[model samples]
Target: MKKVVLAYGPRGFGNYTFDTETLEFSGSPDTRSGPLIIPGFIDIHTHGAFGIDFMSATVDEMRDLCCELSKVGYEGFLPTTVTAPVAQVRQALARLPDDPMILGFHLEGPFISPRYPGAQPQGDIVDPPVGVSEWDPILDDSRLKVITLAPERPGGGDLIRRLSNRNVKVSIGHTEATYTQCREAFAMGARHTTHTFNAMRPLHHREPGAVGFALTENDVFTELIYDRHHVAREAAEVLLRCKPESRVLAISDSTMAAGVPSGTHLKMWGLDCHVSEGTVRLADGTLAGSAITLLDAFRNLKEDFGWSTAVNACCINPRIALGLSTTEARTYLELDPDLNIVARYDRKK
Candidate 1:
């Protein structure tokens, strides 16, 4: 067997040295310099990667995507769904992979506003019927983690209550809800916002839409797409300022266009989308989604907003939002002078 010396610690410290041959650790007692190490990025909202679209991907395809993502430092993610026929949505869910790394499914639409539908297909939008029980089967599964809905829609408040009672995270997004409506939804148990400041109402002194509510409310965990295109550098800094630590989650909101080099048109929710200038837009010039992954977003946050480190945008706060142990959470890794992954371990596990 080959013996190798491994360095381990947060922020690329060589303080805790380990011999990989026997899995025994020791103190290096010397400072090492090389690549900056960070915890495996967790993306709670991602649709697909490496040319696979989650909405139509088979179980094997989803697993393939997860395996590819692992190479890029993504440890886990949610398979996001767009507005589609109920039958198609159910079929997609039925075909999901059972791997724990897949985490769960984030249903992004089908119950959102038609006016600000963004990249979602307009034909697939539907209003929830009174006493609708169709979503119960989908939501009953342990793998369904979060659902995004417009709070002002018909029966949306009740839906939020029911989903919250079931312990499923309900996020407000893709809507035109007024301030009062947002407040009522928060009172009823909406605890998160989807891609704050995009595809939702903007914050105005008089209107105080979802963005305003998210900024003011203490309990809501707001997800910011830090791709720079989604939110400007100054705007992102302002959001981080208003949102309390542990209450902010930086998400990718990535689409199938991620990881692909550039200048490629990909199909998103049945619409043709092209990546240009680091933003994914539909053929008709509507903003579709993001072309960057969570890792890229973290780097952008650090480079643009001086966010201290990638850990500040990637691991620490997201873990807290997911109700994981922050003290024990792995945020970054220490690299030896060679810039290799020395020894790796998670803070929680």
Candidate 2:
């Protein structure tokens, strides 16, 4: 029998020296220098990875995504659903894997502001059905982690309150609500904003729409895409300045084009699409979604926005917002003496 030697630290592995076959730990720590290591990334909102769209994925396809994500250092994710028929949504939910790393499900639409529907099909938009006493059965076995809705829709505030009471996190998105309407929803328990500025009304001094309320509220967590295209670098800086440390959660909002290299065709929201110059758009000029991943978003936030640490965006803050236990092993990178990646093992491994 052999052993492995690993040096662990706060962010990630400091050094790892080992014998592969024998599993023996040996030699001085491999000291190489590199970018600071961070915990394996977690994505709160992502529709798909590789070429498999979540809407169309079978249970086996989701398992494939989990394996693929492991290679890229993702520890967990929430499979997000776009606007679709209720029956179709239920069907997709039925096929998800029971893996713990597949944390839960995020319903991005079906009840949203029709005016700011973005890529969601206009046909799918609808007022919440009356007297739907329980959504639990419809969601299958997956925990309903988060739901995005337009607070201005009929009974929208009531829906937020209902979900909140059931311990589900509520987010406002794809909305055209005025400031007062957003604030009212917040009072009733909408605690997050979905991909903040993308499918919501822009911030204005006069209107103070969803973005405005998100900036001002200390309790509301806002998900930012951080692909540089979703929110401009300068504007992102401004948002960072306005929101509190506990209220900012970075999400990939990634589409099926993720993980695949540039120049791949993928179907999105029932339309053929391609990734061009980093943005995924449809033939009709509709901005489909992002092609980037959570790790890429973290890198962009650090490299472009001058963020000093990934903890707030990546770990501590998001866990707190979601009421999740902080017991998971947090990973990060550290440069060795020679500035290289030192593969270290930790308890979670």
Q: lDDT by residue for model 2 over 1-349, one digit each (tens)? A: 2333333323333444433342233444456333443445678889997877889899999999887866655667889999998878888888998986688889988899889998888898887555653444753343888988999999787788878887788899999988899899988988899988889998997898998988888889999888888888877877889988667888888888887777777678878787887888888867788988776776676676543334467655567666764434444333243323354333343
lDDT of 2 at 340: 36
TM-score of 2: 0.85
**Which ten contiguous residues of candidate 1 have the minimum total lDDT?**
1-10
Off by over 4 Å in 2: 1-35, 133-136, 139-142, 307-309, 327-349
What would the TM-scores of all predictions be? 0.86, 0.85
Report each candidate's C-alpha RMSD, comma-separated, in the order given: 4.1, 4.9
| Per-model lDDT | 0.75, 0.74
If candidate 2 were superposed on the true structure by all CA atoms, what would the RMSD be? 4.9
lDDT of 1 by residue, 71-124 (tens): 666667888999898889999988888775677789899889998788888898
